[model samples]
Target: MVQSIVEELEPLFNPKSVAVVGATTNWNKWGYSTFTSALNGFRGPVYPINNKESEILGHKAFARVTDIPDAVDLAIIVIPSTGVAAVMEDCVAKGVKAAVIISAGFAEIGKEGKRLQDEVLSIARKGNIRFIGPNCMGFWSASSDLRGFMFPLPVKDGPLAFVSQGGNVGGAVVTSGFMRGVGFHRYVSCGCAADIQIEDYIEYFGEDPEVKVILAYIEGLVDGRRFLDKVKKVTPTKPVIVLKPGKTDAAAKAITSHSGALAGSDEAYEAAFKSIGVTRVESPEELLDVAIGFLTQPLPEGRNVAILTPGGSYGILCAEACATEGLEVVKLPDRVIAALDKVFPPRWSHGNPIDPAGDRNLLTYLTAPGKLLKVDEIDSLIFMGFSGFSIYTSLFVSRESGEGAPWISSREAFREVAKEFTRAVSLKDTVKIGQTILPIVSGMASRMGIYHEEDVSELTEIIAAAIVSGRLRVPFLVSAFLPPGSEALAEMGVKTPPTANEASAHFLVAMAEQWVASYKKPVLTTTFFTVDQPRLEGTHYAYPSGRHAARVLIKMVEYKEYLDVSQK
Candidate 1:
């Protein structure tokens, strides 16, 4: 039964033809925004209905829904709340099956408004029509190019699915998501849920093949038991993330008045969420963080983490967060420490966090990552670094350096000397010795994309490590530390500028940890502090130099998740 409903809802987004019952020419009105968004986003035929206007946005406007010349699969109602019933009736007369009501001032207003909402539902029921909302923002379906709301923003098509109780909230989620690399398959804004409730959308997305992560910005749940049942069926197959507002009594009262909702007890909702395996996040940012993590990384088998940082402070913070989140920060075995000692200087911290203190040059930056990744005690690694020397070094060596140079030769010499020393020592477990050095060597070779004398040696070490680590199965999260008053850092380069709050190094770490907890995957983030001037329009926003580390981390995790899941 649930599967059939999911299948049925697919067409609501992928309709062949749509009718805009209250379409208008004024750009400020909801009718105009809905019509324009549909024309811009939907690939299907659109009919605009406006009694007073002959045409809107160059499309011929009909006087009523029944006057449309072609068959209409979807009807968008942008009229006043009091007029929704009549518009819905006209839709039924025109043989429209689905309706999206983008009007406000319905049940959310008061009892008088509730009476009008009840009438609208009655009319839709009598006509056997399924409607989305009476006080909502509408929805968007990337697959179908169906955007039925007033948000005049652009979005990409991907696996994330979002559902929100407020139209503005949905718009914010979509906007923020697009700014990041994450995209969406569908978005739903079911205000008041008078006709179709939140559970309906959850059930629909739960069975959707295109949607891997389901996110909800929820204020209240109408039917707790049914919602939990749906979540139980969905979560094992896909991740369900919820960002519920109304935590305080004041907030709950505000929510109830705003949406005409019965904001339930905050504790009760929290308990229900935990009982159903639904991951609860605190803010909109956390919701997106977890959604991105689930969409990008594989779930770790256990809560044991291997922390890696370019500095000691970040390592300590990572350790604290891991413990607080009920995850064990395992100690690196002596053998692993001994192997690290071969590459790092005497002052390096060879403990679990693996902090190579002092200025980390490009060579150390690149080499340390692979070493931490190869360790057996560490199931996963989190790389934390700051701007200035470390970010420049890592990016330069890993991305910009066209030819393998000084460090490449040094790595080869070290490997050959280590191999001879192991043989001289008659170490039976030279397998571990070879395993530790190989990945570092090969990673450098791969980065250079050429086979030189150094390349052969480095590749050899990496291959040996791969064999020992069972193909080096490790998930890594990267973070970049930023200095205080770092708002100027956002304008340093030709990319998306980071917000002041987003540029904070501590916020980045918190965001990554929240991602791990919410989605059970490793996350990477970076920060920067700069004094560069802001770019004007037509010029791209300048993202700080260190921010690229976070971007790379996000991309790597996403690719890994795609390969793992797709192979399965």
Candidate 2:
């Protein structure tokens, strides 16, 4: 009821019982989708409210909210605009705790609509009832088994919390996120946000333990200062990534009409977001890419970077990205050079990049980046060509084909090949270079370890074990590594990408930024940034371009350093 911050929104998110006020079975209407959405995976009871119908969606229908025999924790209103106020009266009488009004024709339409929205809001406050929208898609949470969106969200679960003012944009976010395997902990399309504003959700999710990162897609905010204040308190503890797209005058006007919100001075929002350490993204893709990077990778320790690329031009492009992000491309220290010298091919670009002489398979590609992580001189790393090796690995797998060898006989073996490669390519996932992944890495600890073989996340490590234990596959890897990757892979096999993936290498830079952030240092760092395949091992928020992503990372790192110094 107009609380400064709506504390414990669990009832709204994880309700014991839910009622669809405008419940209907009309296949084409919003009411149908909204009502049925709850039943898909919601853990509790659902009641459908319809004045005339005896039954809706197979649930015993009620003529009014007051008619329900038990208390209702949440109500979803999708009735026609003219009748919503009466329904609210019923909801208040029935002692509803929260409501999500999916009705339109509100303030954005004209004066009359604003009056109707205001009347309903006043009643809601008087009853001490909190609500989400007068014009919105509602909410969805995987952990609570709730679905209150425009439609059923994919049953995916992860650590990002997304809040959006635009229902369409938020819908796309959840849909795209599901396809990309980027799971969401919560999604609130804070439509109209008549009773509960953006600030409330910002601070709520900022502290929500289930959320590692917060992604907000705002066309506009109802109260900018409230949001800024809440964000300042929250951003320091959890990363807040926002996509505020109402920069142009035309778009600003649309934002106002869409959510009845003033897309206030774009400059002010920009400055506020930056000042509070919020990661401001410009597109949906960036929102998802950065989210995934933050979720999957470990943070870097400082601004010092180690870049490994397969091509010279790609390496140069990455260097430009580094400069754009204010990341220093530190030269290879002597120890790093010596460590890499032992493994690099003839005429390799033997410095910071550790570029192979040419294109290579997963093992060789990973070996250089893996070696670079050992140097204390560098604090972060980026890999650009590792995905190409996914294609290269198949060549070795098919050398024996479906009819030939033992390891190549089953589909599981084929997939195992990729998993083996992923383990090495994803060295960042296996362990924190400076942090302990297991109890100990020393020789003494290895002997004491009960599950030493399972400790490693690499196939190369597994193969090494196989060799040591005398159960080896001789021709596949031995002769496979003798020739250089390009000739060896091509001489053996290197198929063109099944068809190109339009995704660029830019998200890798974003992942790098998020990766280094795991250390909570006042600098940006990453261990993998090499280009290719739309996937980031498994999930990422979006990838704008190396240059754009680097610029965003630069902003975050700068703010971090500023915060650290100011506090000191």
Candidate 3:
């Protein structure tokens, strides 16, 4: 039944002719953007309906929906909330099958508003009219170029499918996606959701062949059972990332009042997410980061991570994070260690968190990463260093004070060495390598005598460039949750902390490690930050944060051991 609905909605997005009710000549009104953008973005025929205006945006206007010369497949209603019922009636009379109502001030307002909402739905039902929203901001359909609302910015077509309960959040997600090199296949802003709900969009995105990853920003779940059912069906084939807000009592109250929604117990929501295999996210950034990872990197089989860094401190922090996430930081074998030793200074660490040190030239960088890539023991590699190494040749040279200006000569020598090193590290590897390029100028300037200000700035810019180029070559997985049964692995010696942020990072690494171990595939990794900690009100209650961690851990377990094969 659900599958049939998804198929029906697909064409609405790719309609042949669209009628815009309440079309206005005034550019200040939403009618202008909605109508104009649709005409520009969508290549289909557009009919503008407005009794007051002869034309809108240079297109002849019809007096009413029924007056349109031909049968329209879709209708976009941007009229006032009070007038929507009448417009819908016209749509029914004209035999418009699908509609997107971008009007607000309905169920989200109050009981009176809800009555008005029900009136609109009643009209649609009687006419058998399927609509998207009464309070939604609008939606963008890449395949059909169906732009139905006044989105502030232009959106490029891509594979990511995004749905959000909050219109503002949806817009923000679309905007952020543009900056991060992410693209979208479709975007639906299900505002009050008086008609078509969140689950409907979820089901649609799940079944969308062109959409490889689905992202949602939800404040409340209207139907838990149905949502879970769809999640169970969708997650194995594609990655679904959800960012849900309003966990705190005060915040939850505000959200409920704002949307006129009954945000169920956060604990119940968390349990539902886990039982169905949904990846719960802490922030908007985390949602995007994790989605990017799922879109780019392969699902990891197990939770064993190998840390590779340019500095000892960074390595230590990564190791601590791995331990907290229950990932095993196994020691390198003698053969692996011997290979690294040949390229590293005596002062460099010989353990699992391999640090080649500051003085190590470009040859050592290439050699160390190559050695790690060949070792079967390491599941994935995390490279941490300043962005300076990526761009400036001078940043790699050691300072030399001499009348002969030996530093200049040294810099040239290092450039040759660095080029060779960059090429080696950037080359494809059987094991996944994820690199973190820190802003070096700021760090160096903060250190009293480590580097001069000019040198620091130059190094920072250089490393930034290198980091950008490296990212282009190596696909990175954002943070992901570990599957269940990770608890058993935890019992096997993996340790995780109680904090959600730390737990999320740890679980991500563990999942990456587990992936390499189980599937013999390389996985790249990254992290997202969060400060949220929701409380559990009862024994049966679950903290949203903890539940999120559990979901990630369970995913890892499933990926590694095939514990939950039904999802696959």
Top candidate, metric lDDT: 2
TM match of model 3 to true structure: 0.72
For all predicted structures, in order, the TM-scores are 0.74, 0.76, 0.72
How do the residues 1-568 of candidate 2 rate in per-residue lDDT, one tens digit apiece? Answer: 5343535476787788999988788978888888888888888899999888999867999999999999998999887788888988888898898888888888878788999999999988777788888888878877668788656666477788888988888888878777666778888888888887777887878767888888898877766777777788987777788899778999988888888888888898888887777888878866776676556544455677767776777778878888766798889977767755554555888776567667453334434544565567666666654333344433332322322223333445445553554353346332232122122222212332222232223323433333332233222332322222323233324432111111212222233333333333222223234242254333333343445446545545564565675467
lDDT for each of the candidates? 0.64, 0.65, 0.62
Off by over 4 Å in 2: 1-8, 359-361, 394-556
- Candidate 3 lDDT over 145-218, as tens digits, reads 77887645567777799888878878887876765556789998877777677777878888888999888888
lDDT of 1 by residue, 432-489 (tens): 6555445555454455443344424543444344333322211110112122222222
Query: lDDT (0-100) at residue 241 of candidate 2?
Result: 85
Clashes of each: 9, 19, 31
Model with the higher TM-score, candidate 1 or 2: 2
> Considering TM-score, which of the candidate structures 2 and 3 is the better prediction for this target?
2
Backbone collision tally, model 2:
19
In model 1, which range of ten residues has the least summed lDDT? 473-482
Q: Name the lDDT value of residue 519 in candidate 2.
A: 32
